[model samples]
Target: MASDPLFERLWNGSAPMEEWTAAVSDGAITAVADGIITVHTTYFCGSVTAIRTMEGLVLIDTAKPDTAQRTLEVIRSWDDSPIHTVIFTHGHIDHTSGIAVIDAEADARGVPRPRIVAHRNVRRRMERYVASHGFNSIVQGQQFNKPGYVYPIGQRQPDEVYDETLSLTIGGERLELFHGRGETDDASFVWLPERRVLASGDFVIWVFPNAGNPRKVQRYAAEWAVALRHMEQLRPAILIPGHGPVVFGEARALQMLRDGAEALEHLVRETLALMNRGATLDAVLHAVKVPAEYLAKPYLLAKYDDPEFLVRNIYHFYAGWFDGDPAHLKPARTAEIATELARLAGGAEKLAERAAILSEQGASRLAVQLAELAGAAAPDAPRIQAIRASVLQKAIDGESSLMGKAFLSVYQRQAQERAG
Candidate 1:
């Protein structure tokens, strides 16, 4: 069960560092609203919302592949009613990988297969996932702190696909699905009119809106803001987010939608303004900032994503890969550049030494960069590997965002393994 004190701490933006540290552990399933059950987790991945209707139960997401069976057990414990529909909020593995369990369970019970629902672009997203399966496996492993995780490529094809809006009368209860491009191109949010319950997939995750994932594909920040604003007007009494605890009350839910939308809007608008004024992407990243008031909100914590990343995403959205810097437009290969820097700095050993000094001085950011250059210059140097490992671990320790920490630790672990 979700703890009341934990919710209270999250609600007040006072959750301690210890609580944030424990966010990776699996959470319990519990009811957030009448007839609405949600599984909240640290990050947005694997969280799901279940809505009970007169005809049957409607599942919002299927959770991750590892957690899918557990999620099904929890749902079965609550209601033995067959799942009438399974609506995927997006094509991300965490949201879609659990469908196999649902499929098998339905077969065991001799029930008809539930109608899988999703946006029209979901198929395309899955196709992309298949095409880049290996690449995604490597990158996502680092991003999610699962070093050897292989992203499951199989997805239960949606029987019902909609371009924009789809209305369904499930068991005589009207449910609306709206297509919104936020974290991913194929994202949707569910709206139950009579129940006044809104299931916002990734559009309104508890942490900073992931409009800017550095390693992922393009994220639509402007369109994401517009979608949030649209949902805000509906005045949902209970907001079940893709991640985080369920939000109750009209006012609180509205504020969440409005504020989350505004944060993205502010980033997009500010970045565009700077670009219009001929500022470079690097300049815009440092210049734009979310309002302090919004930053103070518990729901707006930058646990997964941060403002600078969003700024960079907006930059990439409007401008292409170039950051308006001639030097970066056609830069040398990273390894080559690192080799050159090492040569200029009196060899890789000097770079490694400098990085160790920097780490001791608490200059983790600079230390990691120097360590990377050293590692690139001398990939098999035991001394350089040790410095890189120590420096990167320091950088990881200093990072607050889970996304940043995960990526940083990837190199840290690699360096340690190499040294050993």
Candidate 2:
């Protein structure tokens, strides 16, 4: 273990909930089983897990940029062996960018660089990331509270790409690799049969499974559950999650994976059932729910992704973009609709007043809806914009998920600007 107090508490399974949160967001290195250590690089993306074999060292994820550099320094101080293999859990920049630093280190020492491995789709994802760099930059910036964050260009392509599964024996330690679609289509998880440790990439993040990201591409919710099930069958004694602190024991690891998988499965089942019954998107969004107990688990909190958002992704995958509403098929512009609605309500101020009343009643959803309409109708009205800002601030305060909170903050900033 890292020998830090927080890390010690986590290893003992005696840490409070808030401590778990801190352990992940901040960087640290901890060893689980012998020769297997996980470096929590950056919670915004994922962590890096390194397995030391008799032949050399193998890494699951390199982390990214500055954090990766810091982690690499710590790793070099402890392990001097050449990195023989670098396994990328996924194609995300955070998981792959550390290759640059690793390669640089190898160059400095005049040693062979590690072989980079990933699923074939990881290459395609890297290509897509390069092609859509601008778009990704904007969304990532908004999600992380960086207004103009630019997605790094030219991510490294994996040296080896597998289609289904691959197994390798490094110094008698058997490492099994499998491809399972989850947060990203190219996701892969590592299983060390000998050590009984599972390096579950983003498939098992500490928070809610990011089965659905409102602003991102497709995520496989049902398949994600299947992936977790596969991991549960392995019966790993230690779990190195994509972002969180290492799960120390087998029972705790299995329970956490099951909780995440079951939560995802329940969401998909409920959502698909509603869609099959010809329910509109809005109707299904409000109707579908994961059991309260699933959400109550410490590992399954909606800290990054919400269950309701996953329902939307299910609808998008099974049903197309159409929401089954006739009016939405060719609706008028939002501004046009808002103008007419405000006129009918007497004025934008009237709508804003009603929004304020609803906000005071703790009806944040309805309050924000009305406030947006009011703003659309009269963008220059400072008093109306102030009410809109208040409604948005309330929504921001109530959000549990980091993604939801960051997005709401963007809108709240704009509303505050207009208010002035």
Candidate 3:
């Protein structure tokens, strides 16, 4: 794990400062060699890349606004070259909010505002953001700890939007932009012909592709696979992703891209088949699986997004969330179920005792459910305290998703308070 500092950071987050510092120093960002340039802007969920052409700097995605200011500061530290163009790979907040910061910097310096370019869908995406700001805030609350989301005000729309492909010359080098639907409908990838470098927006995230985020907007797994195949044919020498460290070799990059696409395709096809056969959503979800060979790939590991979530996403795509179970069509509320479960278990203490046993036996799923009931039924019981602790400890020991880990943290805190 310590050997590959980037993987270590992505996986267990256990690398020493010196190792990570060395990895970052090894040109993770702001790489300048052979008069060609690349910059990796680190932001949450996404990153930005900048390339130096003979004409001026061509920036790919500005990152979050605050992060963009810091990114620009870093770029200035290395070279005083003016940013001639800014390409928005997608209209997601993390990718587009930094436009204002870049605009401010260029404006203050009396440099013309860099040309902002994106796919034609970018304007629609921005419009959706403006229209659904409240919905976004509510959905985002489940993930973010802040009381409210910081909605970007006066977001800059793309100055140039294209449907198929657009070619631009920067510093006498030809950079090609291609539209594709992947993590978002508005995704675009930049191909640097001279450098043989590909800046894949969120189209090729290094982590398990987040095609099935349970909480966010629609993701295009089928289209994402298609895009990966398209990029595979290009055979990029250096693959700078929307997140995580860049891949250095063409063969390795192609293999990762191909494997990821194939994995998603398998799931999409299998899920569709089961749905076509009138299988229940649960049956379809349980049936979809990523081949062991593909899962073995280091880049395709389920570090961030779980495959099961993507399976559910596919089910939603086909059948819009009615699970065919008549009872569940308008199911009893959670509190009602908890009350009944509490009554059946003979109050919270018995339920807590059962949960503790389940936790001890490694049945964490059942344990968590029982613990929740116990906590609701007997909020002040010592058994509730014990159940919470046991459930939380199991969660901490397991390899769960990010949201699972966060929920465990919340449970652990609540348990400690009860114990006190």
Best by TM-score: 2
lDDT of every predicted structure (CA atoms): 0.85, 0.86, 0.76
Flag regions of model 3 displaced more than 4 Å: 1-22, 25-34, 41-45, 134-153, 376-386, 389-393, 407-420
Sequence-dependent TM-score of model 2: 0.94
**Each prediction's Cα RMSD?**
2.7, 2.3, 4.0
Residue-wise C-alpha lDDT for candidate 2, range 110-155, written one tens digit per residue: 9988899899999899889888989999999999899879988686
TM-score of each: 0.92, 0.94, 0.85
Between candidates 1 and 3, which one is better according to lDDT?
Answer: 1
Across 108-134, the per-residue lDDT of candidate 3 in tens digits comes to 899898889999999998888788888
Query: For residues 1-420, what per-residue lDDT tens digits would candidate 1 score against the true structure?
Result: 344777678788778534742753455665766777876444545568777889899899998877788777777777789899999999988899889999998898899988999999999999998999999999988898887788888777899899999999887778899998899989999999888889999888787898888899999999999999999999998888887667788988999999999888889999999999999987898799988888778888887787788899999999989999898988889899989999899999999999999998998878888999999999998878998998998888888788888888888888988888
In candidate 2, stretches whose alpha carbon ends up further than 4 angstroms from where it belongs are 1-27
Ranking by TM-score: 2, 1, 3
The TM-score between candidate 3 and the true structure equals 0.85
Model 1 TM-score on a 0 to 1 scale: 0.92
